[model samples]
Every structure is written in C-alpha cells, then in structure tokens.
Target: SPQDLTVSLIPVSGLKAGKNAPSAKIAKLVVNSTTLKEFGVRGISNNVVDSTGTAWRVAGKNTGKEIGVGLSSDSLRRSDSTEKWNGVNWMTFNSNDTLDIVLTGPAQNVTADTYPITLDVVGYQP
Candidate 1:
C-alpha cells in the first residue's frame, strides 16, 4: 500500500535555488519525473528546467564546473551503463538545490502534459 504523506513546498516554486535544497539533511537527490499522460515515445529528450523556460544547470560546488549531463530513467537505472558516464564521477546533490525535470523532443508522441517530478532524498546528513 502507498503511504500518504504531504510534501511541503521548497519555499514555493518559481524561486531560484541560490545555494541548496530546502529539505533538511538530504544530501543526495534522486529525481524521478513521470508524465501524467504517456508520451508513447521510447527515447524522447527530457531535462530539468526552471519556470523561465531555462534548463537548470548543475555544477560542482568546489570546482564551480558544470556537472555531468542528465540521464534518462532507464539509463540512470542501469548501474553498468550509468557508471560508464564520464562527465560526473559522483552521485550527490547539495542541500537546498531547486531542480525540475522536463521531457521534450523525439519528433512525435511527445504529448504536452504535466510531468510530476518527485524527489527522493538520500543520505540524510544534518
């Protein structure tokens, strides 16, 4: 059975993620975005974007360099494949980071629908 728990807004949407995510102690972010209506397209392009239509770009905190590119749900799932990605050699996100996922492209079947992006916090570090 699914548990019903209320998700508090991360200081309301449309705001910038200046430093970190609002959630307490959550260091890693496992963002799972799913469309309410099926796009039917197997390999459509998707990314995390902001309210201003700008794709949210992530980078290393210390180095201030752009991080690895986004990965698909399937690609992110395959340990063998995901580990091969060269851009980002780590799996972690800073606290209070505001991120949103979006799917686009692949010609047709890319239906215009709402995609609910769910965040799964990992390694609670207070």
Candidate 2:
C-alpha cells in the first residue's frame, strides 16, 4: 500500500524583479510516512504564466523582453528525467521531514504580481 503524503507551501516575503534579489522560500514540503521515501519535483509547464495566461516578462527598461521562471530547492537534487523518479539521486526524507522550496527571479523580467506555478512530485518507496 502507498502511504499518504501531505505537502504544503509556506509563503515568504514578496520576490523582487531581478537576479539581484535573494531567493524566496516558496514551499515547505512535508512527507507523512513511517519509512523513508525518495521524491523529485519538476515544473508542470514550461513557462510561468500569470492568471491572464501571459508569460512572465523580464524586469527592466529596454530589456530583451524574454520570458522566464526560476525554481529551486536545497533539499531536492536535480533528476536526470522529469517523468521518472529513480531512488539514486532523488531527495530522501524520513517521516515528517520538511523540505524548503526556493525560487530565484530571472535577471530581467518579473513584475510585482503573483504568478501561480504548478509542480509535479514523483515519489518512490524502496
């Protein structure tokens, strides 16, 4: 049987537009299980779109106007495949472990607005 997991994000201060701003803490993932489990996360979409479905633009005057989104986590390691979760390099957490999710703004275009992004978490129990 598969164990149930509860994940949640703790909101932090607003993110400033540009790489000069420090990374903001986006989420605190909590895994509920008696045994250890390995997990990895990836963006569900390519670009971070706003509620109006517009790609996020870089912040700055006379910028290139490119689109970008950045997400990261210190607890989770990068995986070779987005759809597959191999126990080898994935993040392993014991029962009730909390993982912090961080996001760094792109160099140029970001605004003072909220952009909702979805992430898929792949977990494996071995």
Candidate 3:
C-alpha cells in the first residue's frame, strides 16, 4: 500500500501590489510510501468575480494583469508566463523537502486587496 503525501505552505504577509512579492516557502512535502517517481508544482491565479459574473479588473486590466508565478528549488527555478502554467520538469524528492515559490505583480497600477491563488501539484509514477 502507498502512504499519503502531505504538502503545506507557510503564511505570507506584507504582500504589496505592483511589485514582486516576497518568496513564500512551501515548508514541507511529506512524500510517504507513495510510488510516485517525480513531482511538479505550479501556481494559478483565482480571479474573483462579481454579482454579474464578470471577473474583477485591476485598474482596467484583468485580475491577472501582470500576475506571474515562480517556483524554485536548490538547483532550478522556473516561472510561469502571465498567469499560465508552462509545465515544469519533474522533481525527484525524498521523504521531506521544501521549495521556494514567489508571485510577481504588475509593475504599476494595482489596488490593495487580497488576490486568491492556487498551487497545483502533479505527481508521476514509473
């Protein structure tokens, strides 16, 4: 039987608009007895919608205006292109490992508010 995997992220603070936010550490990834040979992680922007079902706009641009995600490890770093996942190489890991993830915002013209985001983890087996 394969064991379950656990992933967690540390709470981030002081994320300002219109700039590259501070990197957030994916504190832990407990890959137990799973048969997965490799794994990859990426982030996606969860744009908010209004009552009329219209996606929220940031200063005249889509919620994803200049939002981008970057994932980095001790050996490699990859960034998504403007809110889209371009697929990263599979990373082999042991029991516990950590990865640094960062989000970049528009260089200018942004408002102060919370922007929802999602992190997707994909695993592969041999």
Candidate 4:
C-alpha cells in the first residue's frame, strides 16, 4: 500500500522560523525501500523513489516565514505501552507497507527568530 501514501516535512513547534527566513526549497531527495530488496532493484520494491530519482516536492509559494508538511504512520502507537512520548519519534523508514519520510531546513540562513512547526499526520494504517 506504500503506493497509496505520501510523506512530507514541517518544522517542530519549538523549532519555528524567524522573520524573513530564507525560503527553503526541497532539494535532491532519494526515496526507496530497505526491505528484502537489493539496493537498486526494480518493481519488486515499493514507491521508494520515483523513477525521476527525487523524493519530495514543494507545494506552494512562501506564505510566511514558516511552512508545514504532512506525514503518515501505520501503527499509530507502537510498543503497546501505556506511556506516550513527549515528542514525535524520529521515524525510521521501512517499506513494510508503512509511511516514512524526512523534512530538512528553514531555508539557509533564515532569520534568527524562532517559530513553531507542527506535522499533521493523516491516513495512518496498521
């Protein structure tokens, strides 16, 4: 079901952006599975990387000094422990029919101001 999924990145609440932040453009990204498949096999793998050899894309123009992206999770809550983490877990990507991704930057040399970024995850499966 990986083909049915999409991933994106956003700033964390405490890791917000400063004023006039340099617009961060999504750059060369590689997406692929580390599952039983070899490093560069075809079809047998999931939507690891688009044939174009890129991972993510910027959706719209700069709206402010900040931005956001969405992510998805399969097992909403792992470990089955009653406790919850105070922060989001830095996801380890796997092609186990799950969703995983990374988000980098506030654009280079963004203003020194602090801004809050939040990731709204949806379409999670288990």
- The digit string of per-residue lDDT tens for model 4 on 40-96 reads 111111222233111223222344343332222222222121211233222322323
User: In model 4, how large is the Cα lDDT of residue 38?
Assistant: 12
lDDT of model 3, residue 84: 19
Residues 14-125 of candidate 1: C-alpha lDDT, one tens digit per residue: 4232343322121222332221111101111143342212223343344454321222333233322111123322233223333333322221222222323233232222
Error of 3 at 69 (Å): 1.6
In candidate 4 the C-alpha lDDT for residue 8 amounts to 37
What TM-score, computed on C-alpha atoms, does each candidate reach?
0.23, 0.51, 0.46, 0.21
- Local accuracy of candidate 3 as per-residue lDDT tens digits, 53-126: 11122222444343333443342332121221243333344334455544323333345554444455655343
- Runs in model 2 deviating more than 4 A are 14-22, 47-73, 76-95, 105-109
Ordered list by lDDT, greatest first: 2, 3, 4, 1
lDDT by candidate, in order shown: 0.27, 0.45, 0.39, 0.28
* Per-model tally of clashing residue pairs: 8, 6, 0, 8
* Alpha-carbon shift of residue 34 in model 3 (angstroms): 7.9
Clashing pairs in 1: 20-95, 20-96, 20-97, 21-95, 21-96, 21-97, 22-96, 47-102
Candidate 3: worst-modelled 10 consecutive residues by lDDT? 51-60
lDDT of 4 at 13: 39
Per-residue lDDT tens digits of candidate 2, residues 1-126? 666655565555655654433445545555555543544544444444443211233332354344344344344333233232442223334445565555545433454445554555545554
